[model samples]
Target: MDSWPHPQPLTNRLELVAVPRPVLTALVSGRAAAALPPPLVTPYLAGEECAGLWRMRSMQLSDKPGDAPWVTRFVVVPGVSGAVGAAGFHGAPDQVGMVEVGYRIAPEHRRNGYARQALEILLSVAGSSPDVRVVRASISPENHASRALIQQFAFAEVGEQWDDEDGLETLFEMVLRTQ
Candidate 1:
């Protein structure tokens, strides 16, 4: 029932915020997609498939009340000197009080630690929320960069899952209780 807030600039290096449908449409249909890899194209093109993702992001920025429980998405736009990045929660903060996080850096933005920076921000935000007790990340077994980024957060290898839509992925979970 709580309304979400508008996008706010963070650390002068990124903006943790939600994006509207029109802007999402533009990003997917415009040159933005051109800067992403093949794996990100389908979700950008098929809004239906990404409806939950979009709604989560919307709710994060919405002022409307009585919104259902959902995950939040953030567009990681780097500061004046950096390129755009993308990241989001996988679903509503879970019943077990865990949330999953995912992210991608534009091909041009890789190797600059943006993914790690974004993950830290997300984890901090989620951890600060009373409803969130843990944060999880599922990455493809072969994605070394993703695995490495998550390791920096000290997320332990909990298990693996056979994603019907994504083949096999390794699931890592991290406790986010107050330090």
Candidate 2:
């Protein structure tokens, strides 16, 4: 495969790379079916039931070459320990100049600042992209950790959006020009 663009380095602890199939398979297989989170499952199975989290990981990794203009997927690989903790993105590539980020950390890797580190790297990468002028994070209002993480990146509250699928999401905006 050709080298992916904007390969940003996370904290000295982790590295961000294009999400690959084998890594995704390992991530889903490492977790039990019951322990998997709902949001993580739905998109992967196309709203169908699955035996493990592999379906979700598969969906995350199976980014077609020409699916969307603004969307991208990446794997969070730990540098020191060489562990693959999670996968995430820079939102829909076709959404004009707007860049949104979404992500999920594995159950075993929670509370380790992995999410924050990975998000910062993604934000930096997105900000550097010529196609992206602004970056946004649509997080759940009640998700204190996610809210706090965005705050650390200086994402200002822009507005709120309610979707049939994601429900009420607090839209936070950060301008790359200011960074």
Candidate 3:
């Protein structure tokens, strides 16, 4: 896979650290951090559930190597060990210039506003890109926390969809105004 410069999205309390394709491969294999590519150190290790997400992201990186920079990233506090969670888009913007985002905070880190911070960073990136016209998020109806998060960003309820893995999801979208 071709490498891209790491883009670390920052906030007052967090940074979304890029996970290179090589390191993603190592993560899928359940390898230790030492097995990851040089000069990269991630404090987070994927749990079984997160590992499944990582596997999916690994395949995504394989299919669209250029989308690496927009894929999953570690959500960490500066100088902190272990990520508070993970966040990113489903992939690069689609043919119609829409991108879907997903984020998850570790159980222990819940309610600390990490997910909200990550979502802000993701939206900022989408808004700044000329290639992105719509930002979408599909949240499980039962996931009240995430449903509430999107509201803060002015995303409107557009529709619904059923996913093979996640079942029913309430789709929300925010259309970016062209400059």
Q: Which regions of candidate 2 are displaced past 4 Å?
A: 1-11, 21-64, 67-74, 79-84, 90-92
Judged by lDDT, which candidate is best? 3
TM-score of 2: 0.63
Candidate 1 residue-pair clash tally: 0
Candidate 1, 159: how far from true, in Å? 0.5
Cα lDDT of model 1 by residue, 1-179, tens digit: 12223223344355445444455444445444454333333333333445444544555545432222334434444332332455657655666888888786656567976677677767766766888888989999999999988887769999999986668999999887743
Estimate TM-scores for all models.
0.66, 0.63, 0.86
lDDT of 3: 0.79
Arrange candidates, best lDDT first: 3, 1, 2
RMSD of each: 7.1, 7.0, 3.8
lDDT of each: 0.60, 0.56, 0.79
Better of 1 and 3 by lDDT: 3
Residue pairs in clash, model 2: 69-93, 70-92, 70-93, 70-94, 71-93
